[model samples]
Target: MIVFTLLGFMCATVVGIIRIRDLFSVVMLTGMFSLLGAAIYVVMDAVDVAFTEAAVGAGVSTVLMLGTLALTSREEKTTGSSRAVSGGLIALVTGVILIYGTLDMPSYGDPQSPIHNHVVPRYINQSPNEVGLPNVVTSVLASYRGYDTLGETFVIFTAAIGVIAIIGRGRRRRKKPEDQTEADT
Candidate 1:
């Protein structure tokens, strides 16, 4: 019931964001959406993912978006009705296709799922022995999937650096009158 409520809130938030013309409201709603997603992750027994979502989605991303909004327009320009209709139609079709694609996927947590039958068992059985780590999860991620982890870290680092650079440039462009006078003098 709680999950359903959270999901309903998320859906409403998405609709609100889509309809909102105010950039600030959209950014705030985006943060709210992230928070709701984190709650859903918690309900789904994924505390690690929930923590990450809270930190990245609700925390860093919200701040960055607000910084961006400060540097840009507060109100979104209205597009042509034809363009809006076409774009919405495309989005609806894409969503339907995505939902259809998931229909064939195995039900979550099914023991007979191929993932549980094959890859997971290997990780659980062999990780400690092969990687020589007492923690199976650590061994699997740090040892077996080291490159994948490294790639993810590198991507995050790059994204953070990019955001910082963009925000810094925006700050520099907004010079105070006193600073401008000092420079002129």
Candidate 2:
């Protein structure tokens, strides 16, 4: 029931995100959707995924998107679009193939999984003795995938700084005090 509700909320959020009038509201809805995904992850006992989702998805993404939104006009300028029937047909076929690929995936908790044989076992035995960290996911992300983590952090930070740099600088459209005073009159 909770999972279904979460899915419904996420679907509504996706629809709203595409159709919303206000950019800020769209960003807020995206944040809400991320939070709901985090809650679902918690229910599935994926604490690390929930943490990443809450931080990057809900918090950082929303802040970054809102910052970018502030630098641009909220109202979409384009009124109409020509048909892209070829593109739409290609996308539909691709989506069907992707869905089909999911049908033959391994059942959850099968003992014969390569995860049980190959990677997970080595991590279990070698991790505690070597790194002394109980949480293997953290150790893998910080140590094994260290370069990727560094890249991801830099990407987020760069985006945030870029947003700040562009929006914080003086722009021509900024309202002068006289304009506000005249408007108030």
Candidate 3:
């Protein structure tokens, strides 16, 4: 029930984001969507994912977007309807392809699923000895998937650096004229 409610809220938030021309309101709605996603994750017993979503999705992303907004317009410029139609078509097709791709996956919590049958038992039994970590989750993330985690971290760091660079460049550009006039005086 809670999950359904959260999903509904997320859908509504998406609609709000799409219909609203105010970039600030759109950013706020995006953050709300992320928070609702985190709540759904919590209800689904994925607390780690929930924490990550809340922190990265809602928290960091919102702040970054707000910083971006500060450097730009508050309201979004209206684009041509043709561009909107094309974009919507692309999104719809991509969503269909993604949904089709997931159709072959095992159902949630299926005991005979590949992960449960092969991966889970191995991790549960051997992680303590093989990885030397008492916590299976930690062992899996740190040892078994170390490279993947590192790659994700690297990507996030690079993105953050890029955003900071862009924002800083804008600030420098805005201040250059003032600095030049002061120097002349």
Candidate 4:
């Protein structure tokens, strides 16, 4: 029930994002969508995932996008209807392919699922002795998935640097005009 409500809100947000020409409004709607996704994760008992979604999706990404908006136009430029149609078609095809790919997967929480039969048990039983951690979640993330976590951190850091570079470049361009005007004076 709660999940469905969140999903509905997410759908509405997506629609709003698509219809809005204002980039700032779109960014805010995207952040709201992320918050709704985090809420869904929380309701599903994946608190760690919820925290990551909230922090990265809603917090950091929103701030970076707003920073970008600061250096650019507030409204998105209109495109041809043909281009919009082609883009929509591509998105529809991609979504269909993704859904088809998921059809073969086991249903959620099926006991006979490979992860439940194998990986989950191993992590649950061996993590304590092998990793020597009091908390299973901490051991799994910090030990077993350490490399994956590190990769995620590096990706986020790289994205942040890229945004900072773009913003800095914009500032430099703005200042060059001022510098030239001062020289003229």
Could you estimate the TM-score for every candidate?
0.78, 0.72, 0.80, 0.83
lDDT of 2: 0.83
The TM-score obtained by model 1 is 0.78
After superposing candidate 3 on the true structure, give the runs of residues whose Cα lies further than 4 Å from its correct spot. Answer: 132-134, 160-178, 181-185
In candidate 4, what are the lDDT values of residues 72-165, reduced to their tens digit?
Answer: 7898878746688789899999999999998999997577877678677989898888999877878888999999989989998998899779
Query: How do the residues 18-84 of candidate 1 rate in per-residue lDDT, one tens digit apiece?
Result: 8899999999999999999999999987777799999998998999889878877798888646688
- Which is the winner by lDDT between candidate 2 and candidate 4? 4
Give the clash count for model 1: 0
- Give the Cα-based TM-score of candidate 4 against the true structure: 0.83
Clashing pairs in 1: none
What clash pairs does model 3 have? none
| Collision pairs in model 2 | none
Give the range where candidate 4 is weakest over 10 consecutive residues by summed lDDT.
Answer: 76-85
Ranking by TM-score: 4, 3, 1, 2
The lDDT per prediction is: 0.87, 0.83, 0.89, 0.90
- Model 1 residue runs over 4 Å out of place are 79-82, 128-137, 160-185
Any idea what lDDT model 4 has? 0.90
Q: For residue 12, give model 1's deviation from the true position in Å.
A: 0.9
Better of 2 and 3 by TM-score: 3
Tell me the number of clashing residue pairs for each predicted model.
0, 0, 0, 0
Better of 1 and 3 by lDDT: 3
